[model samples]
Target chain A: MRLSPRTWTLIILAVLIALAPVTFPSAFYFRIGALIFVNGLAVIGLVILFGYAGQISLGHAGFAGIGAYSAALMPMHLGLHPALALFAGAVLSGGLAFLIGRPILRLKGHYLAVATLGFGILVFIVLNNEAQLTGGPDGMAVEDLGLRAVSDALGLGLRTAEVWYWFMGLVLLLGAFLALNLHTSPTGRSLRSLHNSEVAARTLGVDVVRYKLTAFVISAVYASLAGSLQALLNGFVTPDVAGFLHSIEWVTMAVLGGAATVLGAVFGATILTALPQALTVFQEYEHLLLGLIIMLVMIFLPAGLLPSLGKTLRQGESI
Target chain B: MRLKSTLAVSALAMMAANPAAAEIRLGAVLSVTGPASFLGDPELKTLEMLVEEVNAQGGINGEEVVLIHYDDGGDANRARTFATRLVEDDEVAAVIGGSTTGVTMAVAPVFEANEIPFISLAGAVVIINPLNPWVFKTPHTDRMACESIFTDLTARGLSSIGMISGQGGFGTSMREQCIDVAGEYGIEIVADETYGPRDSDMTPQLTSIAATDGVEAVVNAGFGQGPAIVTRNFAQLGIDLPLYQSHGVASDAFIELAGDAAEGVRLPGTALLVADLLAEDDPQHAVVTAYRAAYEDRFEEPVSTFGGYAHDAFWIMAQAIESAGSTDGAAVRDAIEATTGWVGVTGEFNMSPDDHMGLDLSAFRMLEIVDGGWSIID
Candidate 1:
C-alpha cells in the first residue's frame, strides 16, 4: 500500500518520535526530547509565516509570552484550568496578530524586521518591568499541569519528564500533520503563491494581504500553544519567553532546519536545543564551540540541512 | 532504520561505560560563566580545589569521591536541563549548585520531583521559605540580611529612616524583604526611592530622600556599583544622616568606587571581611581565615562571600554524606536535615527540617567603612 506524501510525513514523524526514546540514555533524555518538541512547535509556526507566506515576524515570542503567562497567570488569578488557559492564550495570540499584522505586514524587507523587533522588545520590557504582575526579573513559578498525578492515579507510573515527553510528542505529531496538510490546501496554496511573489500572487486574484495575515495569525497561535506547553512542562516561566533573543531563536531554528518543510522544523529545533546540552561538557568554551559549529553548518548547508541533504540525495540518484 | 540502529548501539555502549561503583558521584549545575561569573567562577574554583583535597585524603569512607559539574552560563533554563541531567543521566547521590535565586528556583522542582537532595548557594528567602524536603541552601537569605540591617538601625536608636533600592533581582527582593520586616524592628520607612542597575546619577532620588521630613537615616538595598553611585550621590547631597547598605555591596570594590564618601557607611558583611580582626580564639575566625587564605592563594582572586556560599555548601554536602555513611539520596537528605552546630566559612550552621538555610542573623556581622577599610563594629 502506497502512502501520500502528507501521510508519509506524518507516519515518519510519528515513528521517529516513538523510536527516538528507545535510544535515550535515561529519563533525563526525555526532558531534552521534550525541550526539542516545545521549541520545534514554535519553529513550525515560523515555517508557516516565513516559509509558506513569505511573511516575517520577530515578535512571535510575544505571542508565546502571552500564552506562557496565560498558563501561569490565568490559573492563579482567574482560576481557569491550565488546559483551558492554553486555548485562551491561542485565541488571544491570534487576535493580537490579526490586529497588529494589518499595519506591520505592509512593510517590506528590513523595515518589517525592525518593526517586528520593536514589537518584541516592547513585550519583553512590559513583562520584565511589570513587577506587580510578572514578578519582575526574579521570575515566578508556574502551576503544575497535574497530568503526572492523573497518570499515577491510573497506575501508569510516569515521571514528570516522561509524561511531558509523550505529551509534547503527540502535540508535535498533530502540529506536523496539520502543517503538512496545509501545504496543499487552498489557503496553503494561496500562502505559497504570495511567498513566491506578492505582486504576482495578487494579479492571480489571490488576496495576498489577507493570506499573509492568515499565516501570521496561524503562526502566532502555534507559538502561543508551544509557550503554554513549555511553561506547563517546565513548571516555570520567566519574561525570557517574550525576550528579543527568544524571538530571534525561533526564526533561526526554522531557517536552519529547512523552513520550507515540516520535518525541517523538528530537525532545526532539535539541533539547536540539544546542541548546548551536549556541548555543556566544554565548560567555558561551550559558547565559542557552539558559534563555530553553527557557522560551519550555515556555510556548508546554505539552503539548510534537510533541503540541502535532499538535493544531494536527488543528484546522487540522477548520477 | 540505519540511524536508529546506530544510535541505539551508541547509547548502549555509553550506558555500559559507567564509573566505578566504589566512587561516590556528586553532581553540580553552576553558573560558572556569563553574567553571574563573578559568583560562579570562584565557586567552581573552590569546588575543584576542595574535591581534589578530599579525594587526595584517601577519599570518603575509603572510597573515591567523584565530582560531576556543569556550567549553566547563568541561564535559568539551562539550569533545569542540567538539573535533570545530574539526577537521571549522571545519577549522582546529591547536588550542590545554583548561582542565583532565579537559577535555584528553576531547578528546585527538578530535584523535588526526583527526590534528590539539593543544597543551593543562592540567597533568596523563597528558596527555603516554602522548604521543599529535598532542597537546602548555605547563604544567608535576603530576609536575614534585611533583619540584620534593621537590627543595627534599632540599636543605633534611629527609628525613622529613608530607603533607596535598585531595580535588579538582588536589590528589588532585598528591598521588599526589608519593608516586610521593618515593622518588627521598630524601623519606620519614611521615604522610598529607587535607581536602575545602570543609572549613573542618583542625585534626583537622593535629593527626594533627603527632602523628606523625619528622614533620620538612609538604608540602601543593592549590590554592584549601584550602592557606590548612591553613596556618591548621598555625599553630594550632604544629608549628614547615617547611611546603611546591604551585604550586597560589602566588597572592597564598593569602597574604591565610593572612595572618600564610603567613610561611616555601615552594612552587613560576612566574618570573612574582618577575619584578621576576629579574635584568634573565635570559632569563625579560624574557618574563615583558612578559607580566605586558601581561596586567595589558589585562585589568585580576592575571596568573596559568593565563594564562601559555595565553600559552605560543599562542606555541608560532604558532611551529610559522611554522617549518613552511605550515598543513598534519602539517607543523605535526612542527614543534611539533622545538621546542627556545623562550623564552616559562612557561620555555624544549625540545620533543622523546617529551616533548610540553617543560618541566622548572626551569620551577618555589622561592618563599618572607616578610613576606606572595613571595621568590625560591636
Candidate 2:
C-alpha cells in the first residue's frame, strides 16, 4: 500500500527518532539530540506560521522568553508545579500573541516584520529591566523537572538527559504530527490560501484576518512550549532566550532547513545545532561559515534543502 | 527521496548509538558564533591551545582531557543548556566559559548544584557571589576594574569625569561601581548617560557628556559596540578631553575598530597587550612572550586581556587539579579556594572562600595606546 505524503512524513519522523539512539556513541549525544528536538520544536512552529500560513515573526523568541521565564518564575512565586508553569507559559504566550497579533499582524510585509520585531524587543527589555523578578541580566535558576528521580523510582536505568532526550523527541514527534495535521486540514488550506493571496482569500470568504491570527497564536504556543522544555531540560532560564538575535537564529534555522517541511526544519535544527560542536577546531571561521551557509543556501536552494531536494526527486521519477 | 530518507535515518541512528566516553571532560559554553564572536573566537583559540598544551604535557596527569564545547551564540539560556549537558551528561571535570555576564550568571547555578568547578571568563561579581564553592573566576570583576580605572584617573588628577555605559549588566555594573568608587576617591562624576546594547551611535550621549561642566575625562563603562561608539563620537564631536575606557575595551580589535580615535584611550588591563614593553628580566615577561607567540602563531591575531584571562583560568584549574591529585570537584574547589601567590600571565591570583575574585587592583596596570600599541603608564 502506498502511503500518503503525510503518512510518509510521519513514518520518516518515527524512523528517524527510533534510529537516532543507534548512533549515540555516548550519553552526551542524547543531550545534544534533546537540544535538537527542543530547537526543532520551535522551528516546527515557524513551519506553521512562515511555511503554512505565509506569515513572518521576527520576534518569536519573545514567546520563547515568556515560556522560559514563566517556567522559571511561576514555580517559585505562585507555588505551581513546573509542569503547570509550562502550561501557564503557553497560555500566556497564546494570549499575548492573540492580543498583539490583531494590531501587528494587521500590518503587512516589512511593517509587519518591524512590528513583530518591536514586540520582541519590548519583551526582551521587560525581561532584562525587571531583573528583580527575572534575575535581571544575570538570568535566573530553574527548578528541576524531577524526571530523573521519577525514572529512578520506576527502576529505569536511564540518565537524566537520556530521559529528557527521549521525552523531548516524543514531544517533537507530537508537535510535528500536530503541525502536519494543521497543514492538511481546512484551516491549513485557508492559511495557505491566505499565504498565496490575502485579498483573494478574503474575497473567497475565508476570513483571512481570523485565520492569520489563529496561525500566529498557534505558533506562539508552540514556541512557548519549546522554551518551557528548554528551561526544564537545562534547569535554568535567561532573558537572552527572547533576544532579537535568538529570534533571528530561529528564523535562520527554519529557512535553512526548509520551512515548508516539518522534517526539514528539524533537519536544519539538528545540523545547525551540531555544527558548532563539530567545527570546534575551526572556531574562528564559524561566523564566516555560518554567513556563507545562509547566503549559499538562500541563493542556491531558494525553496530550502528539503523542498528543493523533493522537487529533484519528483523530476527524476517523472523522467 | 526514499534513499535520502534512509540515509538520514541511518545517520541519525549512528549518532544516537555512539555516545562519548572520556575521562576529565571539560565543557565550554561560549559565544562562539554570534556578534560577540570576536571575544569568544579568540577565547576558544586560547582554550584549544591550552588543551593542546595540556594534552601534549601528558594529558592532565595521563587521563586525557576531552573538551565538549557548545556555541551559546551569546545567549544565556543556551549557555545554561550547554552547562546542564556538561554536568548531567558529559559528567565533565569542570566548565570554563561564558563570554557575556548574562550567560555566565545563567550557568552559575548549574555548576553550584552539580558541584562542578565553573570558571567564568565574564567579569560579573554575581556569577561567584554568596560563596558558591564550585565557582571561580579569572577576569577582574567589574567592581575591581572600575576601582582600578578610578585609581588611575585619581592618580592622573582627573577629578571630574563623565560616564557613558550600555544598559547591559556589564555596563551597568561598571557604571554603578564607578559611581560608588569615584566618590571614595574624591572624584566627581559630572554626567552619566546610558544607551542600549544595539545603539550604533553614542553621539547623543557623548554630546551630553561633552556639555557637562568641568569634565576633565570621559569614562566609558562598556565593551564591544558601545566602546566603538564612545571613541568615535568623542573624536567626531571633538570633545578632546581625555577618554578612559573600561578594560573590556582593552583589545587590539577595539583599537582597530575604533580607528584613529582610540589613540590615548586609557584603560586598566592586564600586562598581556603591553608585554613587549616589559623588560625581558621581568617576572611576567616570559609568560606574556610565550602566550603572545603561541596565540599570534595559531590565530594570526594579537592577544587580548581575554586570552590572558583564559590562559590563567585553565592554568589555575590545572594547578588545582594537580594539587588535588584528582578531578574531584570538592577537592579542586578547596584547592582553588586555598590558592595564593600563584602568579600567572594575568596576575598573582589569590582566592579564598570570602573572595572568589582572584585578583585586586594590583593585578591591573593603567595602559595608554600610543603609536598603535599599548604603553604602560608609570
Candidate 3:
C-alpha cells in the first residue's frame, strides 16, 4: 500500500535528520543542525499564518523574544525549571497573540502588515529600553535545560550539540506533522478558504475571526517555543532574537520554501541556515554574495522552491 | 539547477580537511562583517598582519602558525557557533577575538567548556569580572575608561559633574560603570541624562545638564557619532564646561564629525593615538610606532584603537604559548593567566588568577582634541 502524503513527509524528515549527520565532516555541524531545526520550527509557524490563513505577521520575533526571555528570567527570578520556563513563555506568547489578533487582524493587507510591524518594534523597544530587567541591548545568559545531564544519565554519551540536534529534530518533526495534519482538517479548510477570500469564507458559514485568531495563536506558540529552544541551546539570550530583522528572516524562509507546504518551509530553513555557514568562506564579500543569491532564486522561482518544482515535474510527466 | 547543486556542495565545503601536523593553529571568531565591523574589520586585519609577521620571522618555537578565523557578523548566536567550530572542528591550541562584549560573553562558554585559552578584544568588565579560568581580555574594561576620566576630573579639582550617555551597549555600560565608581574619586554627579543612539539632537539632554547646579564638567559615555553630536550640541548650546568622553570615542572619526566643537573635547584613549608624541625612551614608543607604521604601510589606513586591542590579544597569546612551551590547552590557559610585564600596543598586560584583564587607569592616556589632532594631556 502507498503511504499517505503526511506519512511520507514525516518519514522523509526523520530520515533526513537521522542521515544528515553521517555527511557531517566534524562535530561542529551538530550545532549548525540544531540551529536549522530551531529555525525550521519557526518557519513552519509562518507557513500556517501566511500559507494556510492568508495573513501576514512581520513581528513574530516579538513572541520569540518573549519566549527567550522566559527561559532566561523565569528560571532566575521565579525559581522555575528551565524546561518549565519554556512552557510558560509559549503560553504567554499564545495568549498575547490571541488578545492582539482580535483587533489587529481586522485590518487587511498593508494595514495588517504595519500593525504587526508596530507590535514587533514595540516588543523590541521594550526589551531594549527595559535594560534594568532584560539586560538591555547587551542581553543575558540562560540556564541550561538539563537535557545533557539526562542524556548522560541515560548513557547516551552524546555531546551537548548532538543532544540538542536530536531533540530539536524531534520537535521540528512534530511541528511538521501537526502542520501537515492541519492542512486537511475541517478548521484547516476554513483557514485555507479565508486565504483565497475572507468574504467568501464568511458567507459559507465560517467564523472568520475565530479561524484567524486560532491560526495566529498557534503560530505564536510555535515561534515562542522555537525561541525558548534556541535560548536554552545557546545558553544565551539577547534582544536580537526578537529584533525586526529576525522576523523578516522567518517570512523570507517560509516564502522561499513554498509557504503553503510544511516540508518546504523546513527545506527553506535548511538552505538559508546552511547558506550562511557555507558563504562564510567568501569572507568580506559574504553579505553581498548572500543577497545576490537570494535575489536570483526569487527571480527564477517566483512561486517558491517546492511548489514551483512540483508543478514543473507534473507538467513534464503529463508531456 | 546548477546553482542549487553548487549550494549543496557548499555546506560540505565548510568541512575543510585538517591541515598537516606540526603547526600551531590559532582560532578567531570576529565580527568582521556586521554592525560592529568597524571594530572587527581592523581587528581581523591586525591579526592577519601579526600572523604573517610571526611566520615571516620563521615561526614560533619552530612551528608554523595558522590562523583559522570566522566572521560572526556581530551576532551572538553566530559567535557561539563559530567558537564551537574552533574548538571541535579546527581544534586550535588557543583562540582569540570577540569584537564586542556581547559576542565575547556568548563565545566564552564554548572556550571555557573546551578549556581553550581565549583572549577577548571587547571592553566590557563582565567578561573577566567573575574571572573564568580559560578566558582573558586585551582592551581595558569600560570601568577603566570611567575611572580614567574621573581621575582626570579629580586632578582638575572638579568635584561635581553632569553626564549624558547613549543607550547603546558601550554607552550604557560605561555610564553605569562611571556611576558605580564615581564615589571612589570623590566626584559627585550633579545631573545624569541619556539619549537614544539615533537621536540627531542632544540639545534637550545637554540643556538640562548645563542648567544643573554646580556642574563643573560634562561627561559623555558613548561610542560612534553619538558623542560627536553631543560635542556639537554642547558647542551649539555654548555650555562652557570641561567636556569628557569615554574611550569608546577614541578615534579620528569622532574628531572629524564634531569638527571645530571637538577642539577642547577630552577623552581617555590608547597609546596608539599619541604614538608619535611618546618620549623616545618610553617602553611602548618602539612597539607602538613599529605597529602603526607597518599597519599604515600595509593596509593603507590609519591604525585604530580597535586594531590595538587585536594587536595586544595576539601578542599576549604568543607570549603565553612561548612561555608554556607547548600547545596543550590547560598549560596555555595557565600560562596566559600567569602572564606579566608583557608590553603590546594596548598596554603592559599583567595577567593573574584573579585579573584576566590586567590594565589600570595608567593604561589610558587622557587625550584632548587640538586642531583636529589628538594630544596627550596626561
TM-scores for the candidates? 0.95, 0.80, 0.96
Model 3, runs deviating above 4 Å: A317-319, B1-16
Candidate 3 chain A has its poorest 10 consecutive residues by lDDT at: A278-287
Candidates' C-alpha lDDT: 0.85, 0.83, 0.89
Q: Scored by Cα lDDT, where does model 3 land?
A: 0.89
The local lDDT score (0 to 100) that residue A183 gets in candidate 1 is: 90
Over B64-139, each residue of candidate 1 has an lDDT whose tens digit, in order, gives: 8889999887767778888988888888888989888778888998888788899998888888888799999999
Residues B108-163, candidate 2: write the lDDT tens digits. Answer: 87788789988888877777776677788888788888788778877788888888
Fill in the DockQ of model 3: 0.45
Least accurate stretch of 10 residues (summed lDDT) in model 2 chain A? A275-284
Better of 2 and 3 by DockQ: 3
List DockQ for all candidates: 0.42, 0.35, 0.45
- Against the correct fold, how does model 2 do in TM-score? 0.80
The complex in candidate 2 yields a DockQ of 0.35
The candidate scoring highest on DockQ is 3
Per-residue accuracy of model 3 over A224-305 as CA lDDT, tens digit each: 9999999999999778888888899888889888888887788788878887777777876877886786787699987778
Candidate 1 Cα misplacement greater than 4 A, ranges: A153-157, B1-19
lDDT of 2 at A14: 78
| lDDT, residue A239, model 3 | 85
